[model samples]
Target: MKKLILPILLTICVIAISCQQKEKQNSIPKMVNSDGSYETVPLEKDTLVLKLIQNSVRNVKKIENAKEVVNENLQKVKNLVVEACTTGDKPNIVLMHEFPLTGYLYGGRKDKVQMALQIPGEETSELCALAKQYDTYIIFGSYAIDPEWPDHILSLTTVIGRDGEILKKIWKPRNIKRFYSSFEITTTTVESVREKFIEKYGIEEELPVLRTEYGNIALSTVQLDPFIFSAFTMKGAEIILRTSTLFFESDIIYTAMANNVYSAMANIPADSPYGGNSMVVAPSGKVMARLDKTTEGVLEAKIPIAKFRENRKLPQYAIELTKDIFKQYQEEIPANHLDMPKEKLPQNGKEMKVLLDSLSTWLNQ
Candidate 1:
């Protein structure tokens, strides 16, 4: 009888432990699967005017009146938001170019980190208030610093809803490093800090699609990356909101047409070197509204979002056909290359390239 009692108690303990483990697993956010179908997205209105703002960033680093310069830039964004909401055909969403708050500064990690702002900080709060007043969604890109991730600068796209609350904070998916001969982006990206990022935010947050009454939106500053955008579409993204310092107009057309989704790009003004050509496009590669040239202004277009979402289905990827090839191919650089000790972090673009090269399987091969 004594032996039987001991075995029964042990069995009960095992069952309790298993239940706890299952609960923890269930607590995780639903993993976005391309192979699965999601519920139809809802819309607040039938037509929405998407205003893509072509503006310039105001650099305030190493200046005597940094606070004033930052305030002026913030005010510029607020003015644009007010104008878009009050303009002839008021916009449902206002988009801005990357670095509109703190423009790109040519410097090391430390210098740029100093210029990065915190999400939900003072600047975003002001934008949120404007969003509430205008009843319009506001989205923009900025270089941000987070206390959770020390010594790392982040490229971010913040989405504000009509309720004046931050709906989503989208991080740049990945940065293109191979194109430049002597330089590479030194900021923290999903690809750069993959392991730690997933650990903290979960894999679902890596390629999150912000589902709002306006539309199922996905925002990023990454350009020339079809795979990343395609993944977002598969995860039920109906619209792609892109922000960038410079213009890559052709890629926008390609992404929209191929994915069969509405796409918009907001680039800095022509006054800034290599800037301009901000535009909005439809799925059929039709240009909705475009800047004739690189200039500072707003490009607006009306999208029949309700009609567009009626029969929309997830992108039909030929995954089974290409599975073997994808599995066999070796990526140039493995992820988590920059997930090192803070003291060992790369300081600039050149150093970043060296670190990536050393970790490249192909380079070593």
Candidate 2:
């Protein structure tokens, strides 16, 4: 009887231990899959464990839905930008030969030009007509008030395309200058900068003509980007050529070669709606040539056609610009952990890691 009782006690002890082990196993952390990765369990599974799983699955579906929504919005914005550029059809070739074309760049404010440059009205008209004849796009700085829109006097950037079509018959009503206003130096503003430097250095004037122009002539200046601005004057009814903001504005007068010269003397203000430095891509969407913005605020560079074909996803222009900037200033970028702004500390780490992972995958591909 004693042996039998001892065996029963041992059996009871073993059963109790086995029950405890089962409980421990049930409470152990579990792993769950989340968006191509795994996450450890936050709590023990119980009767409510199934509910938590359902909620998690729902949250994941919401995340996927949110991603789709974001992608749709980005595509919409890209499409609108592209559509705005194709509003006008190309000009006819024969119509371009009929009008005489005169083109010049300008300093935006009246203070830029100390000496007067006179362009006759007939010549201006002839140039406008010739630009239409040659299917050439011309930019004429003029002072004009639209007959239909009275009381709206403005120094205008007039754009005329070669098909005898005035692409922007008159764009005073459209504010298009802020997009390209990137250039810091202009011929008109240079003298003022020089004067300030001279005063600070206690240096005597090198030349008498360096004196600054102090006048109030309702002169208008338009900022186009980092490098370009247009200045034109309207006195009573006449528009005249004034000083230009670009140091090389007058360079085209001597150097008009196809490779060196800009495609048209007349382009939209540096910040116009069509302000992108152009990137020409092949039919296969390879970048061929990039019309990069020059230091002068002009779109001047034409990259090799082969370079365009190399990038298929990132816009050729943006990639080239990024590559060039990184090549010159890679050290300026902070390392992965230190790169983000202080305000971004909480969110950036995870996003950055994800982005790095994606980039790594893309590079491998």
lDDT of each: 0.84, 0.27
Model 2, 229-298: lDDT tens per residue? 1111111101111112222222222211211111122122233333222322222323333333331121
Model 1 global lDDT (CA atoms, 0 to 1): 0.84
lDDT score of residue 124 within candidate 2:
43
Best candidate (score: lDDT): 1
**Candidate topping TM-score:** 1
> What is the lDDT, from 0 to 100, of the residue 39 in candidate 1?
48
